[model samples]
Target: MKAFVLDRYGKGRSLRSADVPTPELRDDEVLVQVHAAGVNLLDSKIRDGEFKLILPHRLPIVLGHDVAGEVVKVGSRVRQFKLGDQVYARPDDLRIGTFAEFVSVKEASLAHKPKALTMEEAASIPLVALTAWQALVEKANLKKGQKVFIQAGSGGVGTFAIQLAKHLGATVATTTSTANVSLVKSLGADVVIDYKTQDFEDVLRDYDVVLNSQDTKTLEKSLRVLKRGGKLISISGPPDPEFGKEIGAPGFVKLVLRLLSSGIRRKAKSRGVTFSFLFMKANGRQLREITPLFDAGVIRPVVDRVFPFESTNDALAYVEKGRAKGKVVIKVR
Candidate 1:
């Protein structure tokens, strides 16, 4: 099996391609022949050791999260799928390796690909779409006629969130460059702020929810955009105590996390709002629900580019540039 291996963690290291032994399937897992894989900032951050404390991985691992492939083998307990079933998934934390010819995925984390999409399009949906679902549908409970602000509307998570928020009937506001103003609007954003010229804090006000995916400066500034009792959910984060407890970190790590978010928490409280960090997990059931929306023409993929399998490094670099209007994928088959 040909795969890209991350032998060590560094800021600018490229993964080395190798012919490793094929992975053995577990009782609740399935072996998938890779067709296409989505690239994310999460992969680049993991390679640079940005998540070492929260998500520690052993040296010499395969790195990827989003996958759309076909099942060639199934484990004993995996009754939901069999040979020749098409599936897509954001595999579990320690088990991700879609930047390869073949990868093993837990059955619970995999979903049937939408019949309306191609393999590359299906690969682009899982991670970013699931993040939006968990944030808007599960956590915020956003309703129609309410207002929500999603930062970086042209990015991976941003593009999907704007669509999902609108589908839920919320009036959506988002920030993107002047060039992308029309792009976000086409995705159902009611208000589009050109971040290069106008400040979002000045323009957006009294919103029900704010989805934060920027740095600390942007996170703090978002407070003014929301009304009292508004919810601020940050995906790019200084992890809060709640997230620390969710992951069951050590006491010292928990204390450090509390201190890291103390300033933002206090500011949010002073403004009569609530703040929490969101680290989305993989869920097959949520993906199942999302698939129908695509079939109904309520949502569509906004893919920016598709790189060849061998140019996986180039794809990562392109995403790191922060210029893509939507998701980037690698054609692995």
Candidate 2:
């Protein structure tokens, strides 16, 4: 099997392509012939060792989080899918390797691909879409007629979130450059702030929820815009103690998370608002639930580019630029 292998962790290091042995399937997993894969900032973060303390991935690993492909074989306990099933997933953190020709995924993390989408488009959905679904629908329980501000509306998570929030009937506000104002609006954002010119804090106010995917300064400003009892969910995080506990991090790591988030948590408490960091987990059931929304045309993928499998490095670099209007994909098959 031809795969891109990360030999070491460092900033700006490119993955080396090599022939590796096919992965052996587990009792609860599926071997998928990769058709396409999604490139995310999380991929780059892991490569740069930014997540070493939390994730601690071994050296010489294959990297990719989201995958869309056909199931070549299923594990003994996998009854939901079989050979030839078209599926997509954000594989479990420890098992991710979708940047290869074929990757094995846990059955519990796999979902049937939405019938309306192409393989590339399906690949783009799992990681970012699941992040949005977990943030808005699961955590926030956002309802119709409420107000929510989703930062970076033109980015991967933002594009999906804006549409999902609107589908949930919330009035959505987002931040993007002037060039992307119409893009976010077309995605159903009711309010679009030009981050290059206007400050989002000045324009958005008293919102029910604020999805913060930006810097500490931006996160601080986001807190001020939320009304009392509003929810502030930071995906680009200062991981809170709750999140550390959820991941069952070591005591020292949990203490680090507590220290890192204490100031923000205090500020949120002073304002009577709730704050938590969200590190989205892979869930097949949630993806299954949202499949209908994609099929029903309530949410659509916004793919900026599809790089050939040979250009996987280029695809990662493109995503690292942080200017893609939506997701970047690698056509692996």
lDDT of 2 by residue, 1-333 (tens): 999999999998999999998888999999999999999999999999999999978878999999999999999999999899999999998899999999999999999999999999999999999999999988999999999999999999999999999998999999999899999999999998998899887888899999999999999999999999899999999999998889899999999999999999999999999998999999999999989999999899999999999999999999999999899999998
Q: Give the TM-scores of the predictions, in the order they appear.
A: 0.99, 0.99
For all the candidates, what are their Cα RMSDs to the real structure?
Answer: 0.8, 0.7
Which parts of model 2 have CA positions greater than 4 angstroms off?
Answer: none
Which 10-residue window of candidate 2 scores lowest in summed lDDT?
Answer: 196-205
Model 1 spans with C-alpha error above 4 angstroms: none
Whole-model Cα lDDT of every candidate shown, in order: 0.94, 0.95
Residue 188 CA displacement from its true place in model 2, Å = 0.3
